[model samples]
Target chain A: MTDATDFAGSSREKWTGFSANQYFICLKGILVREWLRYLSQKERFVSSLVRPLLWLFIFAAGFRQVLGVSIIPPYETYVLYEVYITPGLCGMILLFSGMQSSLSMVYDREMGNMRILLVSPFPRWYLLVSKLLAGVGVSLLQVYAFLAIAWFWDVRAPVAGYFLILPALFFAGLMLGALGMLLSSLVKQLENFAGIMNFVIFPMYFASSALYPLWRVQESSPLLYKICLLNPFTYAVELIRFAFYARIEWTSLVVVLAVTLALLGAAILAYNPARGLTVRKQDMGGSQ
Target chain B: MKLQSRSPETPRTDERAAVAALELASISYNYGQRKALDDVSFSIEPARFTVLLGLNGAGKTTLFSLVSHLFSPRTGRIRVFGQDIDRNSGQALRRLGIVFQARTLDLDLTVRQNLLYHAALHGIGTRVARQRIDELLHAIDLTDRIEEKVRGLSGGQVRRVEIIRALLHRPSLLLLDEATVGLDIKSRATILKDIRALVERDGISVLWATHLIDEVGQADQVLVLDKGKLVADGPVATILSSTGTETINQAFSKLTGITDMNVRGGRP
Candidate 1:
C-alpha cells in the first residue's frame, strides 16, 4: 500500500487497486441493465423485429418471382427470394438495433445517465466497449427472435447453421454497434438521430449486399456495386450469410473484423475525456 | 493572499503531505473560444465542508467536470487524496464521489436498482452493496421507497437517492455541484443537513458548489469563484475579515463585484 492509502485509513483500502473480478462485475452490470431496459420497453423490441419481418414477409414475397437469385456460393441450388433475404433480414435487425442503441445513448447523454457510466472507476474504453457489447447482446436477442419467426415461416437453414450463425451474428453485431457508437459520439442531440437515419443508416443499408447480392448490383450499376463492396454493412451481411450456410467467406470475415476494430478505436477516441465529444458545452449540463 | 490554506496549525506530517482530499494546481479549461475555468486552483481539507461559491456561469460545473474526469483540463493538474487525476484517474476517482447538478438517476429504474448498478460499477460485491444500500436507505428514511421507480419519487426523494448512490462506495471526498438547485426550501435544508451530518459522522470531506448565499454556513470554508477565476479562498471568517465586510453576502458581492444577487450574469 502507498503512504497515501495507509494514511487515508481503511476506507481507502477497497479502492487501492483494480481487480479483474470488478471488471467482469461491471461488464455484467451493464449487460443486465441493458437487458432489463430492453425487456421493459416492449415497443423497442417489437419495432426492431417488425422492420426486418416486414421486409422478409412483404418485400421479399412480392419480389420472389421478379428477382431470381442464381446459384450463389452459399446456395447450392436455386432458392426462393425469402430464403435468400433471411440473412440480410438478420443484418437488418443488427443494423437498426445498432443505430437504435446509439440513439438511446444520445438520449442517455441528454438525460444524464451517460454521465453516471462515464464517471465510473473503470477505464473509459472499458466502459464504452462494455456498452458496445451490451448493445450487441440486446441486438442478438432481436436477431434470434426474428430468425425464429422466419424459421416457422419456412425460411430454414441447416440446423448446424443455426448454431454456427451465433459467432457470425456476434461479429456483425459488434461491427454495426461500433459504427453506431462512433456516429452517436459525433451526434450532439437526440433529434439529430433523424439525420443519422437519413444519412448513415439508409445509405449504409441500401448500398450494402443486405437486400441484393453484390453480383446482382454489379449487373445493374458498377458504381453502386463498388459502393456495395465498400460498405462495411455488406461484409457484415455476407459474413452472416456465409455462416448461416455453414460456410466462411474469408474476405468478408477479415473485412468485418478489421472494420469493427477501426470503428471501436475511433469511438473510444471520440469518447475520451481529454479530447472528444464529451467536452461539448451542452454535455456539461448546459451553461453552468 | 491567504488564498491557499493547508490547515497550517496542524503538524506537517507525512500524512498531511500525502493527502489533501482533493487538490488542483494551476488548472485551466476552455470551450471553443470561451474560458470556463482559468488558472483556478484549490484544495479541500479532509473532514470539512468546503463551499464552492459561484454564480450562474462562474464555471462551477466546469470545475466539477474536470475533477470528475468528465473533461480534462487544458492545463494544470488535479489530484484526489494526493493521486493525480490524469495519471491515476482510477485511484483518483475511486476516492472521489460526485453528485452533478443535473439529475443522473435513471427515472425508469427503481432506487435499489440504480444504486446497485452504481455499486457494481465501483466493484463493490453484491452482498456488501445490499447491506450498504439498506443502511443508507434507512438513514435517509427512504427504506420504504426502495422499490419505487425513480420517476415516481418526489424531487427531494430522488435527490436523496442520488446522494445515496454517490456514497455507496464510501468515497473519502464528496463533490456536490449545486446539489439543491431546484428543490423546495425544506428539502434543500434537509439535504444540506444530512450532508453536514455525514461530514461529522463519517469524516468525509465535501466540496459543495452552489450560488445560493444562504448555503454558506458560518464555520464552513469558502472558495469564491467569479468569471472563471477563483477570487477568494479561506474560512468564512477569514474571507469576511479579509474583504472587510460584515456578512458573507456582502463579502461575496464585494469580491465578485455583483452588488445585486437577484440580477443574472451576462451569459445566462
Candidate 2:
C-alpha cells in the first residue's frame, strides 16, 4: 500500500479537476436519489395523478355544458371540454410539482440534508440546476401518467402528438420548477408553505389559460385576460396544448424558455451564500 | 488499510510560509445586529487532532459553517490547505469533509444508498464508490448493516455511517461538530477512539468541536471559543501553563470565565 501522505497527495490531485464525467455522475446521483425517494413515497405519486384526474373527470364534466370550446390554433374543430382541459391539467401537474419540489427543499434545509449538497465540490449553481432537473424529471413522469389516464377517458390526441409533447412538457416543467426553486429560497421556514400556496400556486394557476381560453376570459373580464397573458403558467399551458396536437406555438415556446432562464437565474442568486436569502437566514442562526 | 489523510507536503523551511491544514484570519459573522463570530482567527496544523472547545453558543457551529462554505464570513478569509474557500471553493471543499451537528443521512435510504449518493456527489465513479463504501463499512464494523435503511439504525450506528459518508471522497481535513452529542458513553468513546486512531494511523487532520471537556485529550491541540471570540488556541499543556491552571477544565474555565464546566461535562 502507498504511504498515507503519498496517497492523500495523489487523491487530491485526482479529484480536483471539474471534468464532464464528474458533472454527469453528480447529476446521475441526484436523479437516482430523487427517484428512489419518489418511489418510496407511493402516496405522493398517487396524489399527483389523482389531483389532475379529478380535474379532468369531475371538474371538466361539470363545466362541459357551460364552457363550450371554439376552434383554436391547435384545434381544427371544436373540442370537448375534457379534451381542451387535458393539457391544462398537465400544466396543473407540472405547477403542483414545482411547488412540491419547493416544499421538499424547505424540508431538506430544515432536516439538514441541504448541507450535504451545499458542501459538495461541485459548483453551487450546478447543484441547484441538477436539483431543478430532478424535479422536472419527476414532473414529466406524473404528466405522462395523467395523459395515459386521460386517453382511457376518451381524451386522446394524435399518436405523433404524444411524442411531440415530451419536449414541450419538459420545457414547461423547467419553467415551473425554476419558479419553485426561487420560492424555496424565499421561504425561510417550512411553516410558511401555506403562504406559497395562497400567494404563488393559486394565483399562477387561476390567472392562467389553464381552465378557460384567454378569449373566453377576455369576454368576461379583459383585465383578467391581460393578467393571463402575463402569467408564465399561461404560456406553459398554451405550449403543452399546442404540442398535444402536434403543433407548435412559437410565442409560448419562447416565453417558456425565456421565463425558465430568468427564474433559474434568480433562484441561483437567491441561493447564493454571501449575498442572498441564505445569508439572511444565517444571520438569524437559521432559526427562522 | 487505506484511509483518508493529509500530506505535509509543504516543507517547513520557514514555518510561517508552510501551508497550514486550515487558516482563518480575522473572520467575523453577524446574525442581523447580533454578532455570532467576532473577528476570530486561528489555524490548524496538518495531521493534528485539534479540539474546538465551546459552550452551547460559543460560535463553533458558525465557524464550521464558514469552513464548509455554508455561509461566507462577513469579513476575512478561510483557506483549506492552500486553497481559499470563497475564490476557489471547489478546490477547497474538495479537500474537506464535515460531520454536522444534525443528522444528515436520508432516513429512507439504506446505508449503501446514502453513501453511494454522497460519493457520486463528489464525482466518484460507481465501482470506486462501492469499493470505498465496502472498505469503510468494514473498518467501522457496520458492514452487516450496509443494506439496512438508515432510519432503522441506532443513533451511534447512524453517526458511524455519517462518518463513513464524510470520508468517501478521502478529504484531507475532517470537521465534526458535536459528533457525539446524543450518543451513549460507549458509543461516544468508540467514536472518539476511532477518530483518534485515524489521526494516529492515517495522519488525517481533525477539528473536533465539542462542549464536553472529557473528550479533549491532554496532549491534543485546543481552540477555546468564548461567545464568538477565539479566547485560547494552543496545545493543551501550553494553554494550561499559560493560564496557570492545573487541568484543561480549569484552563478552559479561566479562559472563558465559565465556572460551571460541570454542567457541560458532568465530571469536569
Candidate 3:
C-alpha cells in the first residue's frame, strides 16, 4: 500500500540513533544463519567427525604397537596411542573447521553475499569478530560431536575433563578460527584455498605437536622440537590435552590466549576496507 | 508527469535548500593502469529518479561501487546527505541503501529469513522487522511466497525481494546498479514502475544505473557515461535536445559514437 512507505518514513526517525542492540542483532543473525547452514548440511557434521575418527581409530590403532607412551603429566600411567592423540584429533577438528569457515567466506565473496555484509552499518571489526565467534560456535559443536564419537570408540577422558575441555576447546577453536580468517583475507580466489590447505593447514597440523609429543620430536631432531614448541597449534593441542585430564597447563593457556589475540588482530587488519585483499581486488580488477 | 527543464550548470534554489541525497565530486578509480572511472562529478536531488546511462565497461558499476563505499575513490569525494563517505562512512552508509548488479540473495534461506537477517543487520527489532517484511512482501504481491526458499522463486521475484531488503532500513537514498538486467520485459516494467512510484510517493531519492535506453523516461534526469567519462547530465529532454536527436536512443548512439543497433539490444 502507498501508506506503507509513509509508515516506514515516519518510523525511520524513531530509530535514527545507533544502539548496542544493533550489534547483537547483527551477531544473532550471522550465528543463526551459520547454525541453519550447519544443520542443513548433515554431511558436514559426519565428515568433520570422520577425519578425527580416522586418526583416533585407524591411524592410532596402527601406531599403537609401534609407539609406546611414557607417563605424561596428566596421565598417572602410560596410555595407549589413541588416548595420547585424542586431544590432537580434537585440535584437528577445530583446525579443519576453521579452514572450512574461511572457505565459505571465499564462496560468500564470490557469490556477492560478502558485499551485503561489508556494507552493513556496524564497524568492520565488530562484524569480523562476530563472524569469528560464529565460526567458533560451529567448530565447538563439531569438536563435541567428535568427542562423543571418540567416547564410543573407547577413548574417554576423565568425566570432569569433559566439562573442563569446554573452555579449552573454545580457546583453541577461536585461535584456529582467527587463523582461518587471516588466511581467507589473504586468499584472492576460492580456487587458491586448496593451495592454502596444503601449505598452511597441513603444515600447521603436521609440524606441530598434534601427531607426536614434543619430547618425541626432540628425540628425533631438536630443531623440529623447537618449531613444534613455537607452533600455535602445539599450544592449542596442549591446552586441550591438559584440560582432558582435569588439569590446567598455564603455559599452554597463556600461549593459546596470546596467539588467539595476535591472530585476531592480524585478521582484523587484513579485513580492513581500504587495504583488505577483497577490496583491493574489487578496486584493481583482480590483477592482484 | 510534468518534466522540469533545467540547465546542468545552474542549481535551483529549492534544489540547493535540500541536501543532496547522493553526491560524487571528481570521483575517479583506476584498475591497474586502466582507468575505470575518470574524474566524474554529479549530484542527485532528494526524491528524484536519476538514471545513470552507460554502455558495458563505461564505469557505471565502478561509480556505484564508489558511492556504496565498496571501493574508495583514488581522487575524489563521495557524500550521502552531505556526509563525506571517507570521513564518516558509517553515517553516510547508514543513510544509503544499495541493490548491486549481482544476485546477492542467499538461495538456501527462505524469503522471510533473508529479509529478517537483513533487517537485523540494520539494527531493526524483531517485531518491527517482521511487520516491515510483511508490508513489503504484500506490496510486492509475494506475501504467499514468503515461506519459500529464494532459490524456488523466479528471477524477477528474487529481484523484488532484493529491492525490499534495500528498502527495509528506510534509507533516504537508494542506488540500484543494473537492477533489471536479466528480467523479462514484463518484470522489468513492473520493477521500473515500482521504483518510480517510490520516488513519487515516499520521496526516496534513486540512482538507477543501466545501459538500457528504453528504461529512461521523459521526466527522469539522465547521466550518460562514455568510456569512463560523463558525456552528458541533465533531464531526458535536455539530453535529447542537446544531442540534436529526437529520441534518447538516438541521442545515446550519437553521443557514444555507436551506430550498431544489434549491439544496443538492451544490454551493457
Candidate 1 residue-wise lDDT, B1-268, digit = tens: 0011112232333444467878899998888889888899888887889999888889999999889998788899998888888888888886778898899998888888898899878777677778878878887789999999899998888888888788877777889998998899998988888788777656677899988888998336899999899999999999989999999989988998888766643333
The Cα error of candidate 1 at residue A244, in Å, is 1.0
Winning candidate number (DockQ): 2
lDDT of 3 by residue, B52-146 (tens): 98876788877877787775788988988787887777777766888988888888889998888887776776787898788788888899999
Q: Which residue runs does candidate 3 get wrong by more than 4 Å?
A: A1-17, A280-288, B1-16, B265-268
Model 1 C-alpha RMSD vs. true structure (Å) is 4.5
lDDT (10s digit) by residue, model 1, range A1-288: 222112222332444465677788789889888988887799999999889999988999999989979998888998888988888889889999999989989999989999899888789899999999999999998999999999999989989998999999999999999999998899999888899989988999899887887899999999999988889999888899999888999999999999999999999999888884765788777755
* Two-way DockQ contest, 1 vs 2, winner: 2
Can you give the lDDT of residue B227 in candidate 2? 84
Which of 1 and 3 is the better model by lDDT? 1
The residue-by-residue lDDT of candidate 2 on A24-88, one tens digit each, is 88899999999998987899999999998999889999999999889987899988999898888
Q: Please report how far candidate 2 places residue B166 from its true position, in Å.
A: 0.6
Per-prediction backbone clash count: 0, 1, 0
Relative to the true structure, candidate 1 reaches a TM of 0.94
